[model samples]
Target: MSDFIAEQDRVLLERHGLASYEALWALTLEAVDEPNTERGGWSSVYRLDLGEQAFYLKRQSNHLTRNVLRPFGEPTFAREFRNIQRFKRLGIPSLEAAFFAKRRINTERQAVLVTRALDGWSDLQGLLESWPRLPGVERGEIVTACGKLMRNLHAAGQLHGCFYPKHVFLQRSSGGYAARLIDLEKTRPLLLGERDRLKDLDPFLRRTCAWSDDEVRHFLTAYLPIGTDIERWRLRLDARRRSKEFAVGAC
Candidate 1:
């Protein structure tokens, strides 16, 4: 397939022998300890190794009919590339795109996006799974940091549509803990309303992190101002939790 490489990445692209989209998909990829492979009927992802470094590569294809409702075509790779730029511009820690390409043949469209690997990072899910092993004071500090990060993201008028535990990556820096959100294909502009902000927090609390009511209240205190209507936020979170419990029981 045809391709395009940024001028700055020309040498790296050439060195990796990734000149075309076809070549990139054909290259051998190494499996990490994590479940790095994500597969679906129309898309797939792989963690690729280039010498000692690694990259995250995602490939997607769709029929022209699926592109009818999309304005700039269904090139999700490009969408992710732009979203990563948005996160960085907003001063939110995130990944970097190393390469992107879109190709069309007749009525079919295909795209690929490669991102520089996050080497020394771990998903919040893994950390939370080992939560009991961590010191209580350290855990409280992490939750507070997460709350501040969420507050900053919402204040910037952006929403991470799928804010699940697995999508949040954490790393320990000299200063403290650094957190970043990933899988930004569904990210969109946030409206100027608490409803919009709550939408992000609800699923994150219900489906992702397993924080209790008291913990949620504590987090919101750091997420919002001291005298904010925290009671209202707690009510909303409780409703979300009950609804999730009901849905699971019904199934």
Candidate 2:
């Protein structure tokens, strides 16, 4: 078998040092790969199919300015696998995680967390982009679901560093809508505080509320029941505005 997991059959993978569950799959690193998306996302994301199951393969983001050398080697996917495990333990709704060796994708010889793809999920971003609009009831329900999940994640001591609509996978169901967190890299637990909570909202405000600020406020207020201490959530909104300022300065 080749070094990649491109075939449909169960390939034999050396379990020598695999961390993530997907990495446990037999791999044959064939060059066949699918384009991830049209919108400019992280440069490293790729889509790979192993016949029965599909997987998303991506490289660590090089966007950070400092800490030039990434924490994990380009050779191993252990770091990401550990993070996914953290989420799984917290009971955050997410896909199953796995680890896979990727020598060709990144020179450092690192592993990539292989998450089981949602059987039928269309990213909220794409859904919205294609539809152009959603009904008040539908939109409210959607936002409410997102808000509840975020609250649950926060209470679980986990934060999705990038809590945007795109990162969220939505699938219509008999009840309402089911959501899942795709990436597990930046998510981490934090004490209830200003900076940490603010950091958590930064992504949501930018991605989830890409439209009316008022609607965004309503969405958050509904999901997170911060009864008397509205100040805490207010500060979170402010931090998002501040993050925008830095971007302006850079430009």
Candidate 3:
């Protein structure tokens, strides 16, 4: 069993009597979403409001995943905690963990993860649903920002495995708009080659069906290098979409 708490958040968590694993384990709060039950266990997230500050507390019991490195299985939140730190070190914008702990009590493995909230950020899916109501310039700015974010993440040799619109978040920053990612449970180091880019971007393109060809071109212009063939990428992604559709239909 082990525990960690960010120094910056110590005072706040301590003040709320939640600085220890026992405190957090026994703490009761309203769940933000339905509990996820899988892998012979369950996990849930709760919104914790400490005065004016808000934090997300995730709790899980025996929820495990088996990978090549840990065939015996390990807590999923433990992997997510490590990935959060990796994103911070890579200078990628993502969730910030405030507290993390994992314990083994007899046959049950339990874990807790807490993160600071992105107060003013909005998910891309929500924004896209209202794209038509948004001004043309605002839409362009957001798309361009999101494109740059994707480019930077790929350049850093990272992959946001689940790069859906809901996982990508945007906020109006002092320098126009800034993009951040959430739901890093599936995120990992990117493999070499252009196929890696397609792996992440394909789902994004498929999900954002509201985007016109022109808007997609604008996004590619921002993501690809100058003089790069944007149309080629468009064609490749279109092929991938078709392949995925066929696979789904055949099932």
- Best candidate per TM-score, number? 3
Expressed as tens digits, the lDDT of each residue in 5-52 for candidate 3 is 999899999988899998998998889988999678999999998888
Give residue 72's error in model 1 in angstroms.
Answer: 8.8
- Supply candidate 2's per-residue lDDT for 147: 71
Per-residue lDDT value at 57 in model 2: 49
The collision pairs in model 1 are: none
On residues 1-251, what C-alpha lDDT tens digit does candidate 1 reach at each position?
Answer: 23556566667778868967888867766533443224222666788777777777777666221244566556666677778878879987777777788877676677778887888988877877787788876667667767877887888889888777788777776666777788888788897577788778877776544566677777788789678999888787777667665533121
lDDT of each: 0.72, 0.56, 0.88
TM-score of each: 0.81, 0.66, 0.95
Residue 142, candidate 3: alpha-carbon lDDT: 89
lDDT per residue, candidate 2, 120-139, as tens digits?
Answer: 98787776564336766666
Which stretches of model 3 miss by more than 4 angstroms?
246-251
Ranking by TM-score: 3, 1, 2
- Note the clash tally of each candidate: 0, 20, 0
